[model samples]
Target: MSTVAIGLLWIFLYDPSNGPINQFTSALGLGQFNWLGDPNLAMVAILIVVIWQFSPFYMILFKAAMVGIPEELYESAKIDGANGWKQFLYITFPSLMPTIVTSSVLAIVGSLKAFDIFFIMTGGGPGNATEILGTYMYSQGFVNFNMGYASTIAAVMFLIAFVCVLIIQFIDYKRKKRGILS
Candidate 1:
């Protein structure tokens, strides 16, 4: 689903009185909780939506990585009397490094650029509790009509995202080199 749709759905689901989330919580004796309306929970609410939206894609990526792991490695670990945890630590975990690195880079950058859902859901409201750089930039540019500040914000966002990706890649490269050298 589109970000807008996801945001809208969550907005409904987070409705203070009638939303299913509130209903579920009430059923569990937690009472109806205002999600987006509550400053404390607004960011958490957005995070929950983000995770709900992104989990399936990551799951598929990890599943493919898991499937690609060589069966011989597992057999070798078994012959060496490695238990399940050891096998995972030595064999499966290392094999999934590339996928994990890629996922980390994507997540770091994507999160920095996340705007639509935040805009749709809260517009950085409830006293800016859910405000991120993207939302702030948008507000400065479009809502407040501050072009220069908005442009600067955009540039900074780009640099931050670029640096984050580069850092993650560099770390992954160094780790890979160390593993290969060993």
Candidate 2:
């Protein structure tokens, strides 16, 4: 689904008065609370929305990585009496390290560029409570018509994300080198 659609759906669900969330709370005698309007809660609300939207994608990545691991490793571990947790720790985790690093990089970069949900949901409202770099750049470029500043913000975001990827690669390289040395 498009970000606009997801954002609208989340807005409807999180609406303070007649939203299903508030309604459910009221039904449970917890009373109504503004989810997106409150300054303190708006960021939390956005966090929840982002997590809900992306968790399944990450889960699929993890599942694929786990499935790619050869069955022989797990079979040997099981034969050695390694329980589920030990098997996971000794076999699954090491095998998934590359996937985990790749996923982390993707997630970090995607998050740095995230704008749609915040734009549609809050528009950086409630006094910029949930303003992120992407939304801030949009606001600066389009809303304020400060193209120069917006470009600078975009550059900075790119730099930050690039640095993160480079750092991950460096760490992975060092780990590989250490493994070879050992």
Candidate 3:
């Protein structure tokens, strides 16, 4: 589905009054909740939406990486009596370091620039409770017509993402240099 469609679907699913979530809660006797209205719930609601939307991509990445891992290694570990946890710790985790770093970097950068879902769902509403950098920048530039400040916010966002990428790269490099990841 298009981003707009997905956004609208989430809005429908999370509607404070008639959303499926409230219906389910009412059935369970947990009472209805303002999923997208209450300040505390709003952030949690956005978090759930963001995770729901992006987790599949990251899961696919990790799955592909896992598939590419040589089966022989696990077999040998098993023969050596290494438990599943040990095999995962010493073999699977190291083997997937690159993919993990890549996915983490992508998630960080994408989140920094995320705007559409938040905008469509809340428009930074309920008193700015869900205002991320991307939405804040949009509000400043388009809603408030403060282009200069918006540009500054955009630049800062870029810098923060860049720094995160650099940090991930540095850690990956260190791991590889130390032979923790081959």
Candidate 4:
């Protein structure tokens, strides 16, 4: 689903008086608790939204990586009396490391640009609890009409994202050079 749709859906889901979440909690005698309005929970609510939006993509990526793995390794592991857990710890985990690193890079870079859902859900509010670089940059540039500061924020975001990707790539390269790329 689109970010706008997800944001609007979560906003409704977070409605304290009538949202399904609160209603469910109330039914269980947990009482109503505000999801988005509470600063402490607002970031958690956004995190749930982010996870819901991106988890399926990660699943598919990992599935594809698993499918590409040679069957011989697992067969040999089985013959060697490696239990499921050991097979996973030894073969599967190592095999998935590259994909995991790639996913980490993608997640980090994408999170640096997260703005739409945060804007729609909380606007970095309940007292700046959910404020992120993207939201702050937008606020400075548009809401406060401070383009220079916004530009600086954008540059910093770019630099941070670039550095994150570079560092992850360097680590991955080192692992590969050490023959750990499985």
Top candidate when judged by lDDT against the true structure: 4
lDDT of 3 by residue, 59-80 (tens): 9999999999999999999999
Candidate 4 lDDT trough over 10 residues, lowest sum: 173-182
TM-score of each model, paired residue for residue: 0.96, 0.95, 0.96, 0.96
Over the full model, what C-alpha lDDT does candidate 1 score relative to the true structure? 0.92
lDDT of 2 by residue, 24-141 (tens): 9999999998999999999999899999999999999999988999999899999999999998888888888888889989998998999999999999888999999999999999
**Residue-wise C-alpha lDDT for candidate 4, range 1-182, written one tens digit per residue:** 99999999999998999999999999999999888889999999999999999999999999999998899999999999999999898899999998899899999999999999999999999899999999999999999999999999999999999999999999888888898735
lDDT of each: 0.92, 0.92, 0.90, 0.94
lDDT of 1 by residue, 1-182 (tens): 99999999999999998999999999999998889999999999999999999999999999999999899999999999999999988888888888998899889888999999999999998999999999999899998999999999999999999999999988888887888421
lDDT of 1 at 87: 90
Where model 3 places Cα greater than 4 Å from the true spot, the runs are none
Tell me the TM-score of model 4: 0.96
Ranking by lDDT: 4, 1, 2, 3
Error of 1 at 31 (Å): 1.1
- Give model 3's TM-score versus the native structure: 0.96
